[model samples]
Target: MQFQFHPLTRKEATELISWRYDRPLDIYNIKVDTDSLQNTVDFFVDPKNSYFAISSDLHEFTAFCCIGADAQVPGGDYSLDALDIGLGIRPELTSQGLGSPIAIATIDYAKQSFSPQRLRVTIAAFNFRALKVWQNLAFLPVQRFRKQNGGNEYLVFIRNT
Candidate 1:
């Protein structure tokens, strides 16, 4: 299947905020308001920040993911040497083998787009599927830490590009 990446517009962000989805990435729990997503989109639209979403060629959003410069990484100050990334596919599409390509493509895109030496993703320990995906994609576990949301520890995996 073919795919394209769209830089979400402010209006699109607001619209997407209301689009309901019963899954892990639900906006409600994240406290993502119109302004937050709007600001996110604004940062993504800026060439200085490396963030984007990948969609199918049919114009459907097959996945949502982003890569942040060091300054944007959750735990530390911005550093040009590393990038923080996150991703989630529609729950309905899980276990369909669509992840491999999208994950790899997103990584390649981030590498080329940001020119960072390392790419990182913080995945929950309970997400076996994601762990497998990251491993299959060659991301090695570098560190593990607890999350405030629960007792689950997040594994910080890294990929050298």
Candidate 2:
């Protein structure tokens, strides 16, 4: 399946916030709370963050990703100057061998948008699937720590751009 990145639209953002994945997959879901859909819409209308709606050749929204400093790492720490990235595939698309393509598109978009020496990704320890995907993409484990909020263990990986 061919994939491409496009600037996230308000409609896409709304759909993203409304999407809910089942059980285990929900663990990695993007958490956004706003009083109204418009508020949620306003949040993503920023130029600084490279927010992209991952779409298929048919222009269907398959995933959402951001390449920016807002990526949260456990303890809010990172050793190197890097572009932090976050990604999420559509709920129904999980475990379907689509993550790799979406990830590659995000990384390629980041590489073209920013000139960081390295790229950093923080993944929940339980998300072994994502860990393997990043590992396959050549991102190496750099740090492992627990989130103070939920105490969920997280692994930070890095790869030179």
Candidate 3:
């Protein structure tokens, strides 16, 4: 399926604030508190960042992804210069074999938009599905560390762009 990306609008950001995934998947959902929403809106509006709403050929929202440097992930200096990618599938679309496509689309976007030497993704250690998706995309495990906020362990993966 073909995917098209567009700037995330204010209305889309508001709708995202109320999006909630199912039980286990909810753990990976973006925090929708007032502060978080404000930050998200600010990030989305920044042209320097590549945060966007991805839509299918039918113009239905399929996922959200940021393919730039604004992603905060636990890692070392090696990631500082790499294009970082963060993504979330629509709550209703999770586990329907969409992960790989979403990841590929984001990576393709990063490659086209930034032309970075490398691409990096930080995945929660327990999020096996996401890890698998990165692995499938040829991202190699680089490091494992704990997030300062929640102390949850995460793994950093990277691949040459």
Best by lDDT: 2
RMSD of each: 3.8, 1.9, 2.3
Model 1 lDDT tens row, 31-100: 4665577565565466555445568863476666766642232442333356888776655666788877
lDDT of 3 by residue, 15-82 (tens): 66677977666766668667577887776767677678888964477788877665656443443577
**Candidate with best TM-score:** 2
Cα TM-score per model: 0.72, 0.89, 0.86
Q: Name the lDDT value of residue 82 in candidate 1.
A: 65
The parts of candidate 2 lying over 4 Å away from their true place are: 30-36
lDDT of 2 by residue, 1-161 (tens): 67787778888878888888787667665576565768766666565666788889644898888787767665757757888999988887788888788888888888887877899999988888899999999999988888888677899999998
What are the clashing pairs of model 3? none
Q: State each model's CA lDDT, in order.
A: 0.65, 0.82, 0.79
Worst ten-residue run, lDDT, model 2?
Answer: 28-37
How are the candidates ranked when ordered by lDDT, highest leading?
2, 3, 1
After TM-score superposition, what is the CA distance of residue 83 in candidate 2 from its true location, in Å?
0.7
TM-score (C-alpha, index-matched) for candidate 3: 0.86
**TM-score between candidate 1 and the true structure:** 0.72
